[model samples]
Target: MPDLSLLDIVNLCDNCRVHQPDPVPSPYDSERLVPFYLSESPDSPVIGLLRPVIVEQLKLENQRSRDSGQRELWALNVDESNFVSRRNRPSGPSVSFRDWLDTHTKRTVAMKELCERWRDTLLFEDVCGPKKWREELYPVYADPFGVHDHPNTAAPGQATNFVFEMERSACALFGVVTYGVHMTIYDEVEVDGEKTLRVWVPTRALSKPTFPGMLDNTVAGGIGSGMSVFETLVKECMEEASIPEHVVRKYTRASGAVSYFYRTSKGWLQPEVEYVYELAIPAGVDPQLFEPRPSDGEVESFELLTHTETIRKMRQGLFKPNCALVLLNLYIRLGYVTPDDEPDYMKILTRLHGTFDFERW
Candidate 1:
């Protein structure tokens, strides 16, 4: 979602007033009531709702949404400032960080132990450590322990350009993240008459969520929604495929962002950013069967799709919208299809006519 400030909304409302008739009072009329309302926050029942409402309305107006014209309404009844953590608290009595670490290091399950130890070490009993404390743990647990830093830290000099949409009652903006991945396999197999290459996608899972914004969007500490493309891929690989570190770190052909899209969610067309990456699996190993995931309860089933099969599935709308774009881009990269290498849809639509871009929620 895009963000807007109160002044921005005032200017917009002013513009709306110019083109359309003022029905009741100016939307900014509440601005005049804020100072008085805040003064009575201690006991005024009306002040409790009214003061936060004014501030939140301003926040909503400033927020980035898919719809520019309608995003203002999200302010209506939202207790925007009351964000609470849904994380499960530790069971049993709290212990010192060092004590927790001593206990966790003996545990057999590495990921859970590490996470519990980390939470206790970082957030328990006022560690009083600087934000940079996370950097110390990065090398220790980042990949192997599933305690990795998110790609929320954008590289210096990088800037984001937003895509905005307006709905009847709300609006949002599209934000993109640059992402890359490489897949490779090496093994020997018999060809027509002699030993030959059996190039295949070595990844165990074919359809796991990879993009960032597809899951969560709350911007924290300068990180916006759709910020963790690499992290998301890493997470998916870990949970769905059990891909090892050596395999993930293996160098192979790196495909730049081939293309991307935003599927407007249904009902008011809430906006969402989407991204795609393509990589070739080097010749040799046999493709692995993806086991159905239990930790990630949402995974249905996984299957390997050949280049031809993947394209057919994309064309048939059998894939999720983001997954479809990923498959289409993968097809183009593998020479199963050709695209203009531009991000715009019309160019590709012109090249491959009678196509459909699936709308996702």
Candidate 2:
């Protein structure tokens, strides 16, 4: 929220106490020229952090004036364009997105190599001493989601935690994506016999565009953490699924199973925050009433599935990998199915693509 930029850091470094300016005779030959030096407000927070070396740098700049025979030889000028993004018209990083992506690609490749080396070191260390291996090599190989072991031996717990925390912070920008599940119960005339609970999925649940040009092939994606969980949920619901603004507000309830995720994508491992909610449908409201609105034309078809049929569909990989798992868990947790009823979670297992795996903490 602060208006500070990188220039503020650079300028702070440039101006030092040793750089006081010296007076010179005016060219007009009447009055002596008063040497000017860079100055800033005393109340600025940045002023306190200035090290002695920075002050010395500033002093050198000030002395340069008299040597160059100029009064305003070393002046601090705040760059106006330092903060703005060229493509997006926002003020942030100096590097362009293309450049940033390229750098990320290189980093990802390097990290992959580093992870491999760490893995090899760990394997070698494991043969020597188990205790030494855990202490020395595990910390370095650990992943953010705790998938890998920490390879650093110095301080195993602290070092791994530090790395995981750092990795989580680095990739937090991509945000979260989640799916909502709903079921409509249709009853027959009989009180005990033939009733059906039909599961309905929104055509467009949550998604971000991977390619603007190939909207038709675009997958459902959501930007998480940019807004609060509920805010993001509502926004994504509207964007991908075409949940009517009023309808979403009306049926949405806080079902309270918030889960935390640390996701790696595009070479950054971001923190993903998400929660689930279930809203009761009014008696008159039909599940068929809602139509799927594809975000990037990713919707194949929308159909209602019964409990047994849903499980069968899961086995056939009708949904996204993680999405299928999430749906299966939701169904089991919500009592739509029994825990003993193990649906084919394998259907949800798909190779993760387009996401960068973080090896470095």
Candidate 3:
């Protein structure tokens, strides 16, 4: 196969951006999705985007619950064309999605039960096939652009801007913006008296559900509900790479984040944000101290590759789509990919941070 250009690598992650006219044209747009609202109020925030199939399923579920004299979980406002949490009480006003989940005593339990029930259905099998079921819950943030603060707060929902938690497997089904942390760990070494960086990259375990046997970042994991970015980073470092907390805390530096709207091959929407980090080990430090070993079955093995080799593999499509994006961001930050050499430098930079603003949808 021919080598992919740097822009091609970026396009792989942010492929949705390459498709024009925003909302997508009809006939060919069977995957056009609708915004999911927190409440029936016009001002309520859009917490997710829902594909037509999922929306139809939800509508049917709502009808069935209402017909059986059970509480309807969702309210479909025809006038506004959005889905919201149905008012549980007849006398009281409708509650926001966050309040409904938090006060109903179920919290995230209701959603979990729903997913479990759907696990046996054809719709579930189609949207999130067997290989994609992560059995993990990912938080849905109300304010997508807001800061995720109060990481250590004792209160259940006070720590972050999350409204509710859904199965990670079903996130793409709901078209929610999922958050994760990716750390590129590398060592600066002197080669013939010149400083060069060698990065540690991992191959995903073949038994893994998604992107099995694909190249991945040194350490990466989703930020589960109630977990802070740093907390998730430290945990992933140890769990995925066997790198202890102290080494991570000392060497890892926050290197901003990459946001992009991606559509899976199955046509499911995935608007995601990956918090990027860099772990730089100085030239004189013992290499063995910072080296990564696969402690979790999620990774097959770890390999240290030079900068050139890393870029070559990336261009060859050896890396997972988003992982390649993280590597591209790393190269840009390290001064290896710049405006002078890369003609699409500005375009690449903008698309790297392509926030899926609701208005654009």
Candidate 4:
């Protein structure tokens, strides 16, 4: 059953206001889908490592949505700062970063490990020690495209944007940043003589630390050190979905990216970029027929859902943060949601890209 009943109202941000739609009986009706609430984070005081311009750029995106004059966009505007995360964040741990990052002083176990490890490796220095550090047990995240670069690093401070530890990246220490890929998979469906889309949604294994047991894109993995974008996509596809090399190479197509500075539970910053892809699972065949289990333990299972149901669950805050952003990108690019459908269409486009200055990187 769709969660549309409860999802009828949403927020662009906590402070943004809401206008409810006329209640409709049939959940699938597109007319009723319009005028729903959207949760978009608004700008406040400067925080983390982002510059005022970059931060304002993000707020402008939300401002467009808020400023939309009674457009029939999905999701209505709402008020107050409480319940902010509920608008977009997939259900997870309690309100941690959205509230405590400003007040909390202690780091979580994983974050402490990252901090200690970074202190040992001279993360702030430009010495050759970084190379030797990579040989150790630490993670090395390389941002070749500099997609995670930000403008807050001070003059003459070009972003090294290379070799980050897994724990550190998770902790967002010293304004450290990283990149990854999120591929959304879908199959074409002909429902009642009309063409529609059904997405392949993956459930993350409950053992994972972040957003465990939450819904995710079909295959999403960090673009680890030394791998190109396509390389990471193919590797993740095989591991997470049991997709073959041939299928990945032929079926996976780049679908741009969704970039944001996500605030995680442990108070670590995530100035991250998720290079998005759309993998079209051939209509007649899926990985299940050929592979009985996932090559990796990250994913628990895969389920195909209609686009309506997918969005409905997403509004219910069931999708992982990055996963939800990736899905929104797909919705925008596929014409399922349009300028008419979204009041802040252009802002949404700009904000989703989360463009960073490559020249400084």
Candidate 5:
């Protein structure tokens, strides 16, 4: 409900500047500053956690992509000039028609209809009509701009939650995208009288509808319709980690964010932005000693792993895809992983943060 969005996370970084032992240099030109640094290179691997076939779909919005300081967005297999092809512009005044209704437009026909509607519907060929789509998928489409206060959620001035569905959110078609927040609860550990690092990782509940028995961040949750980014972060910390409000308010730092356009194994177009955070536990509390009693049933258990162990699990693909990217980003910022360590470090960083149209938080 508040004006806060992931965009505000960029401002949180200003407070962190003085505390950073080795701060990344800020360029004289405002365009080059890193709220989260990213290169506007299409050839750069921006979409992590997706298969190569789906990743190749990332095409330049314009030949001048490298020239645009914002690198505003990355299109998937569509011409840049065309409005329908834009990745995150769902509310634009446009519509593509279809004889069959996989999902009907309740209030606005233009919004319910999409550019890649037919292409998206083909994957669900066995299913039919908007009513059927709702019956089957039961997607809780989210309003990216946080329209929670709007009295009539079903037909608010903005598009309803349906816009976030993969097919409905198709870049070259629907153009809407979703957002969330991810936080890594970390602390400095003393092993063998030497200083090291340890991170708290959560194993998702096996009963979870998606990615059961997988790994996740210390605390993570989606930024749903009408909820502000900070609100979601605080709420998730309490629910997921049982982290107290005082601790979260004092130690948590809004590090940065990552965005990506992914094609799920289930065949949906998922474009999302994840605002990242770092919460350092007090010296009196040991990460391993604390029990993460998940208030929500989403997490099965919690394990504290050292940096080496974390990377090993990452290589094995134990963590959920996006969570893995978030960890990799944390490692890079911590200087645990560097450009020299990987051949495509620069590209990895660019794609890891993603290309977003949103201005700096």
Candidate 6:
């Protein structure tokens, strides 16, 4: 098969932008998706986009919890509608999933309890089952906009303006946007009097729960609940690639970020933003010192591939989906892929930096 184009790679990550009409139209069926709100007020900001199945499950769980004399973690407000048309059509419930948790207990504790209960029960077994559960907690911001600017120095429950923290595994169930950091470590060398670029790429451990045995960025990991972007980058570098803190601080450059809404083959929503960074080993440095070795079991091994070979592997779909996007962004930034060569230059650039401004959706 021919190598995939840059546009094809972009489409792989930003796959869920198109809106599909509900086939069995109901009163709630319209252009907009069910928005998960931070509060009960109609004016509250939407923190997530809930799928139909997830919406139904949340409503059922809310009713069940209330019937059992337990505090309902979520409140369904059917009175207010966010639908485009108000022609006597009963709109879908505006779910205030975090408000009750925020009021009753510390959001951090409440969300943990809620997720633990769901994990124990049969609810969302496909995604939130014990086997699939990732014990790591991810923060949910009340206002996710401009959150990257804030330092990750806050405690578990005290991220800047964050509403709550949820289990990383269960985040897809709520369709919330998640944040992570991705870094590309590369080097430039002169071969046969010609300049050449080579990148350090790691193969994911086969034991990994997701995307096992696929190629990945040199250092990449999700920003845990209380960790900042750079902090996560540094931690993942050492943990995954055995790169030390001083090496990371000296070589890493904070590149721009990429955002995309992805739907898994299992039909789970993952709206994600990855803060991108690049670590370039300066010329004349001993390659052995900056070389990546698998420190943690997360990476099976590391390989340094030439620019042509790296793009070939990417085009062949060897890398994890989002990791490929990070590399694509790298190629563009380093001038390997440019407007003069790639036909869909503008389109590729636009999709890579998706606004993620859901109001227009």
Which ranges in model 3 have alpha carbons more than 4 Å from their true place? 17-30, 78-107, 126-131, 149-160, 190-195
| 171-244 per-residue lDDT for model 6 (tens digits) | 98777889999998898878899888899999999998899999999989998877788989989988999888
After superposing candidate 6 on the true structure, give the runs of residues whose Cα lies further than 4 Å from its correct spot. 18-32, 78-93, 98-100, 103-105, 148-159
lDDT of 2 by residue, 15-55 (tens): 11111221122122231111111122121111011122233
Task: Give candidate 5's TM-score.
Answer: 0.56
lDDT of each: 0.28, 0.32, 0.76, 0.51, 0.52, 0.77
lDDT of 4 by residue, 1-361 (tens): 2442221212111111111221222221121111101112332111123322223333443455468752221121222333333334222111112222221122233334434454576653222124323222223223334443222332464543332333433224333345678887776678999878888888888876467898888888876544667888888888788878887788778977777544334322355677888877665675554332466788888888888888888777787766776777798788876888777667656656653322122
What TM-score does prediction 3 earn?
A: 0.87
| Cα RMSD to the true fold for all candidates | 19.0, 24.6, 5.0, 16.4, 14.3, 4.5
User: Better model by lDDT, 1 or 5?
Assistant: 5
As a whole number from 0 to 100, the lDDT of residue 275 in candidate 2 is: 42
TM-score of each: 0.36, 0.37, 0.87, 0.56, 0.56, 0.88
What lDDT does candidate 1 reach at residue 2? 37
Please write out the lDDT profile of model 1 over residues 165-266, one tens digit for every residue: 111111111111212232222233454676432223322223422322221110001112233545454555555445544544452233443223222221
lDDT of 4: 0.51
Tell me the RMSD of model 1 versus the true structure: 19.0
Candidate 3 — worst ten consecutive residues by lDDT sum? 87-96
> At residue 198, what lDDT does model 6 achieve?
94
Top TM-score prediction, candidate number: 6
What's the distance in Å from true for residue 243, model 1?
1.6
Instruction: Give model 4 RMSD, 1 decimal.
Output: 16.4
